[model samples]
Target: MKHPVTPDGRYFVVRGRLWRMSNPKLDETQRSKLTNRLMSARRAVRAAKTANDQSAEAAAHRAVDDAKRVLGERGPVWWNDGSPDLNRHLAKNTPYAEWYGQIGRSRPGGT
Candidate 1:
């Protein structure tokens, strides 16, 4: 998805690539809502990082939930590819780029 970097620069991908949807438009309310959702996503990640045990899964889930809450059905749907599976091997076996590529292959056009 395209995401704006700042007030001046145009939107870009989360992995820092230039977006195909250049100068894409978004209303102020939508921008505000998206900003809030991204903030929640960050917090969820932080919580998961701080968690020490199996309970960290709860924090990860919360992060995904908050992301969905802000992004709405689009965000939640985006977050649901793996469902409840939190396999650590998913990390160890593939780089983020590779993993995202696989996910994209599994769900074309981001579903």
Candidate 2:
């Protein structure tokens, strides 16, 4: 299911927590490449787990991290405004609290 993105576009909310988005400035080609790499790394991680290879799993995890860093989904905030990286924080505990509340109230069956 698609999650809600904050108005600023810096993050998308999932289960009420903020997750950073990829850098909007990245060239399409580069973004696609990095995303592909990330997927491959994830597959490798699954394979390693299935094979019970601890070292390979660790390396795959690192590769996934590297790709995410390059994609601007991790590491640092991609926006230039110097806003604190609130990624992984609950929306109710951040500046997005009111917005998140409004979303819930607007949804069907929302309290």
Candidate 3:
């Protein structure tokens, strides 16, 4: 995963490396939910940067707006240090579990 850097100018270093995806505690369901969130975040970050750099100020702002729109409420919930806090909530009363369901379950139609 790439990380944003501000060594001088704003830039994200492309680590250009993919890591294995797995979680013993996360059932298939949770893993899937996290994966989707991660993917969406990656795309959003990319879009935001692209908009910030490639497009006109207005258009770039729109791209960033669209990217943020895509991010939805998953912004705060993050996969940190190889684990996810399912207890995190986008709202005062909502939890990841309540929103995305249980984790670590095999997908439907398995042997």
Clashes of each: 0, 0, 7
Per-residue alpha-carbon lDDT of candidate 2 for residues 13-95, written as tens digits (9 for 90 to 100): 87789999999999999999999999999999999999999999999999999999999999977888879999999999999
In the predicted model 1, the residue pairs found to clash are none
The pairs that clash in candidate 2 are none
lDDT of 3 by residue, 1-111 (tens): 233222222122222211222333457776666557666656665776776754444454554444433333233333345544322222213222222222212323211
Say which candidate scores most in TM-score.
2
TM-score on alpha carbons, each prediction: 0.34, 0.93, 0.30
Q: Kindly provide the TM-score of model 3 when superposed on the true structure, using C-alpha atoms.
A: 0.30
Which wins on TM-score, candidate 1 or candidate 3?
1
